[model samples]
Target: MIKYYYPDGSHCYRALHTAHAVFRNEAGALIARAEKPDGSALYEFEITGFELVVAGERCT
Candidate 1:
């Protein structure tokens, strides 16, 4: 699930994003996501760092 992902407070200086995460199952793999707050998949979404996502919510 997407929510179970843990967010790191950095998006790298080259790229600007509020959240960056990696699934618990993966190691040393960084990820970027733009899903809606309601757990719906977004064709195009924006990140403002104010999302109330949990640690186990799925996105689709």
Candidate 2:
């Protein structure tokens, strides 16, 4: 899963590597706004059909 942090120090999570849909809500509109729970927005991106994967161990 993907762990997203907010500007206010809060965070959320999402499943990665799956053909699932992701979203973000801002000012009454849903867009690619993965903002930190602290109200901080993340890197600007227009993505779809991909899950978020957090940093973890790597296997070979």
Candidate 3:
């Protein structure tokens, strides 16, 4: 699993097999838009603030 962190210390997580992801928070939201490495939008989400633990495969 891959971990993603915010400068503030929050985190988000995802499975290596996850094809898409969406994260949200109180202040706002973030879209971990997916693609085929060629840059595409598989899916997206609105998240807020920051994340704590993000796990997933790194896009090529």
Candidate 4:
């Protein structure tokens, strides 16, 4: 599972790891994805006018 959060919105997805494995260690400032609630195969990938909100991954 993976949850990509944007400034204005957020996404909770159940990724097919065998096909598209999104590793947290390799995701840099992004959240360390684990199992989450209300997940689906449906996903959206866009950061045009949004900012990624990660916890403790940045020095704010």
Ordering by TM-score: 2, 3, 4, 1
Per-residue lDDT of 1-60 in model 3, one digit per residue for the tens? 434444455756544444356454465545454444444546554433323235323331
Every model's Cα RMSD, please?
Answer: 11.2, 11.0, 9.4, 8.9
TM-score of 2: 0.31
Error of 2 at 40 (Å): 24
Q: What lDDT would each prediction earn against the true structure?
A: 0.33, 0.42, 0.45, 0.34
Best candidate (score: lDDT): 3
Query: Model 3 segments beyond 4 Å from truth?
Result: 6-8, 20-30, 34-43, 46-60
Query: Where does model 1 exceed 4 Å of error?
Result: 1-25, 36-60
Between candidates 1 and 2, the one scoring higher on lDDT is 2
Model 2 C-alpha lDDT per residue in residues 1-60, reported as the tens digit of each score:
765444455555554432133465464332344444444445443432232454453211
TM-score of each: 0.19, 0.31, 0.28, 0.24
For 32-59, candidate 4 gives per-residue lDDT tens digits of: 3333335445333332122123432321
Top candidate on TM-score is 2
- After TM-score superposition, the amount by which residue 59's alpha carbon in candidate 2 deviates from its true location, in angstroms, is 19
Error of 3 at 17 (Å): 0.9
Give the runs in model 4 whose Cα sits over 4 Å from its true position. 16-44, 47-60
